[model samples]
Target: MENINEALGLLLVGLTTVFVILYLVGLIGNGVIYLTNRFVPEETMAKRKEIVKGKAKPTNPAKIAAVIAAVEAVTGGKGKIEKIDKIDKIEK
Candidate 1:
């Protein structure tokens, strides 16, 4: 029937319009993100650099020395005990 064909055609057209609109929106959103990243970029690289450099400081020197001493004790003098620097605890 002519009415059935018209209804099917209109349904297909509506679906096609919705798909195109969604595709365009997604494309535009991605473009905006890319542009913003290019122009107004955050300091991800700088923060990463700082994080890499910040780990170089020794946190617990006493814990490290204790671990080393235990390893030497287990190894039975194969590992000579290095000179242990006394770490004074910081009284808060």
Candidate 2:
């Protein structure tokens, strides 16, 4: 009984020590991340948003020919493009 109690106590102590060490490591990591983000310059962290602005234009004949060729190749000449609609760009 004494040996069993001693083993249980050692197990509890080992688990508690590991938990405390892991908790401290997580806190330190979070603190480092917070400090780094707080001190970083905005220009260095700014990301560019690519915006394409253009009016709805007719599709080029060369592009249409290429699309028709690709579809024919994929479907063994069974596919056909009846109509092609131009998508207008939305301005934000």
Candidate 3:
């Protein structure tokens, strides 16, 4: 009876300690994020220049649109793609 009560008491204390620590960590993390977002200014990105090469094929606007659509769909319209670089095929 005494052993059982002691075990239950210890369990309760351990669980409460864990919950309180986790809650504090979450609060601190949220505070840090809020402070950074409030103080930091976002930078504007430069416009992409069209690349023209003698032998390279032209980039398709349709492909870029499709990729943007896919990303928006996956993020439920919250996803933002800053830049997308196309890899070139190389010959050995």
Candidate 4:
């Protein structure tokens, strides 16, 4: 009975220690990210925001032709591009 009790106690302590360490790591990681973003310059942040939002620009005709050609080749002339639109990349 004593041996069983001692083993259980040790197991509990080990689990608790692991949980505390993981929690602290998560807390510190969040804090660092928050601070870094908060201190970032507005201009740089604006650029990042624009990139995240996927601001559209005129497409190069040569690039568009190349993409269409590749798609047709891959699909054996069955693929067609009706429209193209910019999509923002989602970050976790």
Candidate 5:
């Protein structure tokens, strides 16, 4: 009984230590990712320009009209007209 109790105590301590180490490693990894995301410079404009140029698509006026109509319908067609004008002006 004494030996069994001692072994169980050691096992619990070992498991606790492992759990703490794993938690600390996860914390440090997350901090690194956050810091890098905040401080790292984004892709250069040349790269961005190339990427955008590669994916050009013709504008679809009908889709734009449909979305505006949906917004007006959802907003009960009252304040929506002013809201639509605001959005159009902002886009311009």
Candidate 6:
């Protein structure tokens, strides 16, 4: 039927238009992120010369990562570790 054909054509046109619009939005978002990163580079954190002072051995990166992950999980991603210090002894 001519009506059915016309409806199908309209549907196809609408879908194509939406897809093109979404694709353009995605492209623009990516372009903005790329431009921002390129123009305003993120600052790098300074590396510590000594993670532990006197008697304490160097800390393992895996342990640090696990601790950070645990803190994030506990705080629901609101926690941040500013500094880590070695505990010489624990009081009862």
Listed in order, each prediction's TM-score against the native is: 0.45, 0.47, 0.47, 0.54, 0.47, 0.46
Q: Which regions of candidate 1 are displaced past 4 Å?
A: 43-92
Query: How do the residues 32-67 of candidate 6 rate in per-residue lDDT, one tens digit apiece?
Result: 988876876344211232434333343465666666
- Candidate 1 lDDT over 40-62, as tens digits, reads 64777566555456533345766
List runs of model 4 lying over 4 Å from the truth.
56-66, 75-92
* Number of backbone collisions per candidate: 0, 0, 0, 0, 0, 0
Better of 4 and 6 by TM-score: 4
Expressed as tens digits, the lDDT of each residue in 1-92 for candidate 4 is 99999999999999999999999999999999999889988888887676556553423556656667888999999998765444222122
What lDDT does the true structure give each of the candidates?
Answer: 0.70, 0.68, 0.69, 0.74, 0.66, 0.69
Among all candidates shown, the one with the greatest lDDT: 4
What shift in Å separates residue 40 of candidate 5 from its native position after superposition? 0.6
Clashing pairs in 3: none
Q: What is candidate 3's CA lDDT for residue 26?
A: 100
What's the candidate order when arranged by decreasing lDDT?
4, 1, 3, 6, 2, 5
- Model 6: weakest 10-residue lDDT segment is 44-53
Checking candidate 4 for backbone clashes, the offending pairs are none
Q: What lDDT is reached at residue 44 by model 5?
A: 57
Model 5: per-residue lDDT, tens digit, 1-92?
Answer: 99999999999999999999999999999999998767766665456555456443225556557767777788887635322222233342
Q: Model 4: which ten-residue window has the lowest total lDDT? A: 83-92
Candidate 3 lDDT, 1-92, residue by residue in tens: 99999999999999999999999999999999998667765431111223322233335656767778889999999999866655233211
